[model samples]
Target: MNDKRKKLFLLDIDGTVALGSELLPGAADFLQTVKENGGIFCFLTNNSSKAASDYVEQFRDWGIE
Candidate 1:
């Protein structure tokens, strides 16, 4: 028998993951760790000022896909 559990991490974008165009300290590391451990991390934002494409571009600038 095989036993494995899925891991999902729901994170905020503004203050938790980043501030403006900069990513907070250890944020990248934490995300990388999650990926390395076979976990998934998703971003959640309540701000409606920017479009989803804007965030995609921003994340690309930070070397995150």
Candidate 2:
């Protein structure tokens, strides 16, 4: 989140950014804001129970997909 510099936001989709079947408050807005402003983001997770696609679906359900 620097001015005109290379930046990236890495997000964890489990309890850090989401709770059981629910998205954390401001999580969507935070992502959307970064996307809308041309900021970069990468979702990095080490979930043994799921993968990136799983997060994709979950984020979609939370309106941040």
Candidate 3:
């Protein structure tokens, strides 16, 4: 474990992770991979038009944790 390292990923939800209201291709898989590799991530959005629960449901719809 000498090469153990920490990684933190900050991802935007609007365009990077999703488009309009749909999750982009591979976005879910990418997040899953990061978790599998012991990496941390935070998903954010500048738009406040939607509620936090909406985002959670969106992620759930996209099959992402």
Candidate 4:
């Protein structure tokens, strides 16, 4: 695999980083670690109930993205 180039980690919420209305353990830490290491993040949520702005607001509330 080409691990030379930087990677962009696409993480999903609603269980991966959160559950319904609650945050998951270690999720923020993991995201920070990767971000600090120069990795890109693109949050992907399966719940189509909300728009991209909604997701961004959620992350902002968590002080994450």
Candidate 5:
């Protein structure tokens, strides 16, 4: 029998993932690595300046989704 546990990463958007419209160095690679390792990552934000839809659009523009 084989046992493996799924991993989940909850990351912050600002500074952690990106600063403004730019993606931080290695952020993309880190996320890709998570997927490659059968892990799931979700973005988290404490800023309420933007709506969820706006973030979705921004993420798409950044090639995150």
Candidate 6:
């Protein structure tokens, strides 16, 4: 593996970040640590009923970026 290579983490929202409106423990810390270690991440969801902005708002509500 290339240690210099940048990493990208595609994280799921439901059950991963939260179980409804609540943010799971260590979720924010994990993401922040990844960022501090020079990693990038994005939130993914299977539900297409809501737009991307909706997810952004949800994250904001959870105090996640």
On TM-score, the leading prediction is 1
Candidate 1, position 52, lDDT: 94
Candidate 2: tens digits of C-alpha lDDT, residues 1-65: 45865468887767677776788888778878888888878776676787667777877777765
Candidate 4 Cα RMSD (Å): 2.6
Model 1 segments more than 4 A misplaced: 1-6
What local lDDT score does residue 15 receive in model 5, on the 0 to 100 scale? 98
In candidate 5, the residue pairs with backbone N, CA or C atoms under 3 Å apart (3 or more residues apart, or in different chains) clash, namely none
lDDT of 5 by residue, 1-65 (tens): 57576689999999999998788999999988899998999999999999999999998887787
The candidate that wins on lDDT is 1
lDDT of 5 at 20: 83
lDDT of 6 by residue, 1-65 (tens): 55976689988989997877788999989988888998999888998888899888988887777
State, as a TM-score between 0 and 1, how close model 3 is to the true structure. 0.85
* Superposition error at 36 for model 5 (Å): 1.1
How far residue 17's Cα lies from its native spot in candidate 1, in Å, is 0.5
Candidate 3 segments exceeding 4 Å error: 1-6
Candidate 4 colliding pairs: 15-18
- For model 5 the TM-score comes to 0.85
| Angstrom error at residue 56, model 1 | 0.8
lDDT, candidates in the order shown: 0.91, 0.75, 0.86, 0.81, 0.90, 0.86
Instruction: Evaluate residue 13 in candidate 3 and report its C-alpha lDDT on the 0 to 100 scale.
Output: 91
lDDT of 3 by residue, 1-65 (tens): 57666589998898899998888898888888889998989988889999989999888887776
**Clashes found in each candidate (C-alpha, N, C closer than 3 A):** 0, 0, 0, 1, 0, 0
lDDT for model 1, on a 0 to 1 scale? 0.91
How well is each residue in 1-65 modelled by candidate 1, as lDDT tens digits? 57576589999999999999899999989888889989998999999999999999999899788
